[model samples]
Target: MVETDKPKQHRSRVLEGMAHAVSQKGYGDTTIADIVREASVSRRTFYEHFSSKAECLVALYEAASHNSLKVLRDAIDPAHEWQTQVERALAAYLGSMQANPVLVRTLFIEILHLGPEGLAARRRVNSVVADFILSMVNGSKGPKSHVLSSGMATAIVGGINELVLEYIEQDKVKYLDELVQPASDLVHAITRT
Candidate 1:
């Protein structure tokens, strides 16, 4: 059991290191050495976990995305109406991003630099988020709810990503909360149709 936990712990540490290194140096400039150093692990340890720096960054992005989704999930108020629940989730999600500008820059902006691999990882994360949105919308108990098809759910995620990217590129990730209203409204409009 201890042996099993060691690899998992080392892998998680490397992912955390990748986030820290990329946040400090940008993904393009970050090196494996920097990652291991940030992780307080050796080069051999990083190699044990990831084949390359880009791979490590992708791993970190996926982990961060899941964590952010958890924040959204935990913000939900089941007793409230679905729309109110949606707004609350969005508020929590954006609020978490606003509090972690460096994380936003590393995961959001830096991931785009890795060509096909980065895009693939991003697509996977987006699909997961879309599925979560589908659950939230379709699982609600009311009319005009669950009308969301998977395609439409994915589209909504993409549209909101574009909105957030606009802010990220402008070094305004701290203002992510500004998107809560627009994002919730877009969901409302699309679901109503």
Candidate 2:
């Protein structure tokens, strides 16, 4: 591999190893050895990129969150009706989650058990999502009387997270797209009022 590609390859392997390790053993029970073994790398190689498993998990979560946000952003269309945009965004968000159930499960479930740092990461991701929703709502509101507030945007993000969590807990992740209509409707009601 090229010199620069080495770090990227190692990081990708570590993240993939994290997903596999967590999926097999649960994040709480997985160890550095398990991750290294899963990645087919030495312990020293793992440490070169991450100080600890928690840090690795945070990196995994951040990468996934960034990719998901890109999907949501790309799905938006200025020419579309606001409600349609909402539906499309929600669908794209859920679709990305559905495409990566292992990572999604680790993110929405396992990462929560990582304590304060994990919570902070989760909140940071949620804030990004909320900001995206807020921007979409603001852009589409135009001169409409009803407008969504920042607090409302946060609540909406929380609500959508809850909905996704429920589906994940039920082992129905494939049905995530089913949430698009309800989520869009919720946004519609909140934005119209």
lDDT of 1 by residue, 1-193 (tens): 6888999999999988888888888888899989999989999999988888888888888888988999988898766666767778899999998887767886678998999999999999999999988887888766663378999999999888888999988878888999999998888888883
TM-scores across all candidates?
A: 0.90, 0.93
The list of candidate 1 runs beyond 4 A from truth reads 1-4
Q: Encode model 2's per-residue lDDT on 29-89: one tens digit a residue.
A: 9999999999988898899999999999999999988999999899988776556577777
Error of 1 at 106 (Å): 2.5
- Provide the overall lDDT of each model, using Cα atoms, as 2-decimal numbers: 0.86, 0.87
